[model samples]
Target chain A: MSDEDFQEPEVLLPLDAWHRAHGARMVPFAGYSMPIQYEGIIAEHLWTRESAGLFDVSHMGQLLVSGEGADAALEALLPGDIKGLREGRMRYSLLLSDEGGILDDLMVTRRADDFYLVVNGATKIDDIAHIHEHLPEELTLNHMDEQALLALQGPKAVDALARLVPGVEALSFMTAGAFAIAGVPAWISRSGYTGEDGFEISIPAEAAEQVATLLADQPEVKPIGLGARDSLRLEAGLPLYGHDLDPETTPISADLGFAISKRRREEGGFPGAQRILAERAAGSAFKRVGLIIEGRQPVREGAVVQPDGKITSGGFSPSLQKPIAMAYVPAVSAVPGSTIAIEQRGKIFTGTVTPMPFLPHRYHRQGSSK
Target chain B: MSLYFTKDHEWISVEGTSATVGITDYAQSQLGDVVFVEVPAAGTAVEKGKEAAVVESVKAASDVYAPVSGEVIEGNAALEADPALVNTAPEGEGWFFKLTLSNPSELDGLMDADAYKTFVDGL
Candidate 1:
């Protein structure tokens, strides 16, 4: 690559050089030069599972939906009942187009009288523009341009985080709260992409380095790159914006109908509500599912999904200790235990569709007995 | 026994009719994480400069070429489940296979350790 190869996007991380100095294999991701792996991806992936992994995710868009009428303004673009979301509570919702296809899935949280939104790194620009164009003028969309996002994830994440930012344990899953991390005012959310117990910390851009350094000093934390992040998310059965989803994929077909509230499905007010509601009631043509490959040979993106279905993302999964993949297969092939074939280097290999999170998800579900 | 390397970053240690093969440290570094290794089964014949095995990282896959023509008498099945062995000790436990050299003269075509070091430095 050349600088010409990438049309630079906004939101670069504060620790770009630090990542390179540590022998990080850098790649262009979400408009930033970020480490894809350090000390190799497999090691980082396994380390994250067995312990904790720290990820620099500042390139993602963080914005505050505030001012009068913000809640109603946002409700027009998404199907989720944002008005019902209480302060500090978070909900996973989709940004939909007129046809009910998904533009992106984002987290919407309620503040005292405002909404805080976090959107995917790759689609944040479009997400912002979509909000600006759709929402009423009384509402204001303020993008927090100078902020850094860090994710500390895995079984040991809470212990490591609690040591630095006290009272975080009380926040619970799908919750966000304002707190001071090492004297720096920040927002901490008990949410992440790794399907492990984790926290996503958003700190001021100037304070990012100090916070990252503080976390790096912990014995349980190591800087994980995009390479391990990909495998971890793949193993977790989470979707990557451009790969697992796009404007063409509706939430129903993507198996994300759960994000739409029951009231929203019945009332039918959001974009593409007709198509989405019909799909929800009638089922979709194809669905996204996980695959456990027969051998050690890991398939990759665009490796023709044989017999017609195609894989959007595929790689060696560190969590499962085997190769796994996510693909859009025909509805018949999307069921768990359905046999399929993926072609690599002109040869077809056998695989079976398996429920996602190749490893059981360890999210801190609320109201569970300890 | 002296170790020699090919330009493709494969290293071979030859003592006589037998040789051990693995990837060079530089190759492993470029590969990032070693997740899976697919080696030719034991008793398989491999031609020089041909794809005899594969090593995969989270990001991509690479073909490991045979530096010398030979019959693979032993493949490292341990790598199938524990590919990290290659990252941990590429020269020792990470060795991919043991080959019975079909043509001893092929050894002369490989670069010695010193030459290989120079080759890697330039890369």
Candidate 2:
């Protein structure tokens, strides 16, 4: 019953005391004691969709990759267009095995001097080991363990954060830059996992509480927890590394072909490019698809997808007011409008294979946020 | 008629042989924003401390257990359409089912209202 990774005892983040003081219901997750909910998941989720929701995601791995040929070294280990990543822009990419299966998904930013990588918390150690083994000898990878990460996300996020850190509104979606928040030095990216207009701030551990308290005091910001973070990302149709994605899953099968940049597809030297690009050209055996459950009852993860595999992730979607899920099914059964049957707890629940992002993304671009 | 409590946080109001069963308000508050409820069909037999229903929130799913052995005569069909009843009125309109008690003596093993309050407080 303990789903914990057990790699180590539960650890606390820099914001642990801060979360505890704010009535967070802490749960052990990915080897850290994390807040699963404060007021409630549904309320916080809805709040993010309307206003700004602050999230403490310091558990994710933050690294600085530098030295000559770091971009090419990273390209050899990943499928992203790293060499071409312009300064201050961030790209979502996947770390892949030689066979083209996903090692992990990550966000790689091209800073002025080096690359800034943010990877999943649970797989951070393994990711570091993998990178160290494969990265060129000239490159150096440093784990920025002394930093804490926070995401201020939603429609009102921009205005509220702009008040504290001037000129942050100038950055567009998927952009990264340095900013001073309440006079605290921080690295901020105009990006987030919630598919809303937001900013991800990386600040020193010592200044985390002060910076977090400043943001929390904002009229538009309410402290959100991992529970709402999951639901919010689910509505955005993003996959969690340990759940919807894993080592056994390939980028094509995971519907992450976008990470395989255009130039990489043509250049064809990245890890598992042969197998991955082939699967892309001639579809994978199974595909990750979204589901719309027929009724009120939820069909959770591990439910058998009739004539195929299992539901990788599922739950009630507060945004849609119905059950939504992501699952792997045979390529033949992956059509957008096709209805599939899932059996859980001795009963069958009807679900339609709908296109992902059950809700529309409201990202802020340089031109428009609406 | 008397209300008895189960360790699993269920309450059963016994009137002669028929008992009304539902979760305590505390359980619903902990569950938060109940989106759906799945109850055992009427006419099914359930044993004490056995799974009888499931309540799901956006965050997680929990199994609601039967507090006493009985034949289920009715399920709260209203919950099928409005699961938030569990959060709004956990002990009243949110009642999960009605069952005819098979062993009336099982009620003695449960706590009284005051004891149930103390038990919940400990948690």
Candidate 3:
């Protein structure tokens, strides 16, 4: 009903100086100064899909949750099978409210004595506070703000990263392990947001610039900005937390049923379990679906569509050489073949509802594609 | 023949009453790789400061406003197939449309290349 009143001061990332030296176009995003582009968004996007892209995502909230019942405690806050998560394995899960709304979507990894979490950057402050309120006091939640996160992604990401960290090629998709990169102790995960075969490396902040320089020196790797990172994730059919998944959006409404593990779905112990389970059975009012826009103009996010749909995420697909978008439409118009029109600035563009990952995912799983 | 610019970053080259319209190199660089371009059809009347064309990049779509009131002479058909031309040659073949100026006096409010360069630098 009113204008947003909260505006926080932006901070600089660990590699801010490094990015400036490399001719990155810096912009404000998620309360931090981030690189929107280096060479160019389209060029960087294509390079990442073709070869390798090095992304600085240190703004994300990395945390360590430790205690005897930390796993079950986290499971209570999310509708994910946290207890079933094996050590060195990662699970994409949602931080849900008790009233069935989404707070954030995060990646959780089971460690030897604690659970590791990587939460969305913008909501990390609130996410940590929310977790604290839900978890038991005995469990320690340590924010790893002093660390930096880098994602090396592409088809050649494995070969490029193996140049510094040997034997990491053995880790399969959705797996994590401790590895030494550039003589610095780091936690390397074979899971990435790009839906490409890549690794996410976490290093100490002091050593961030050196590691990034070493990785960027590789012929296969180039510094990609937030623009390319966003395009890459959109192509991967990944829902950004602030854009696609919001407070009013449930996992079922966002078409994130895969995040709700089978055990959790049946046991129904997590927050908002009753309402979510009901929606899972009798369809939510709106369903998230993919669209291949018929024109070159990207149906940008926040555009409303015909026959009752609201776009959550939309952009140009570099891989498909077309425009693509994700929107939530009424159940009746959620069919794959349905045609929708989006009117922007007095011009109308037609779009067709299609299956997502507008480009095929290149994730290397154990033995076969999932 | 004379060239003029607008605060919105559109550029117009005047040859008598008919003028060629396109965005400046500064604008093309700002918008990045343009994937789609939609110019008003021939015979369509556009008013100064009103939307005349649309340009879309991978990140977002932007409206291209008319620098002066005119009737569209023709839209660039080549742009319908290849919009990246706007990026490579924004001032030449990348022109969005040719307009028959209804009021040549409207051009006086626009900026010259030197003034536009100063304005862009200030921005």
Winning candidate number (lDDT): 2
Clashing pairs in 2: none
Tens-digit lDDT string for candidate 1 (A116-190): 899998898899999999978777888998988999998888888889988887777899899999999989998
For candidate 1, report its TM-score. Answer: 0.88
**Position A156, candidate 2: lDDT:** 96
lDDT of 3 at A114: 95
Native A-B contacts reproduced, model 2: 0.59
What does the lDDT read for residue A33 in candidate 3?
86
The CA lDDT at A345 in model 3 is 56
Per-residue lDDT of candidate 1, residues B21-122 (tens digit): 999888887776788888888899999989989888777888999999999989988897789888888988999999999998888899999998998787
Q: After superposition, how far is residue A15 of candidate 2 from its true place, in Å?
A: 0.9
Q: Model 1 chain A: which ten-residue window has the lowest total lDDT?
A: A1-10
| Docking level for model 3 | acceptable
Model with the higher DockQ, candidate 1 or 2: 2
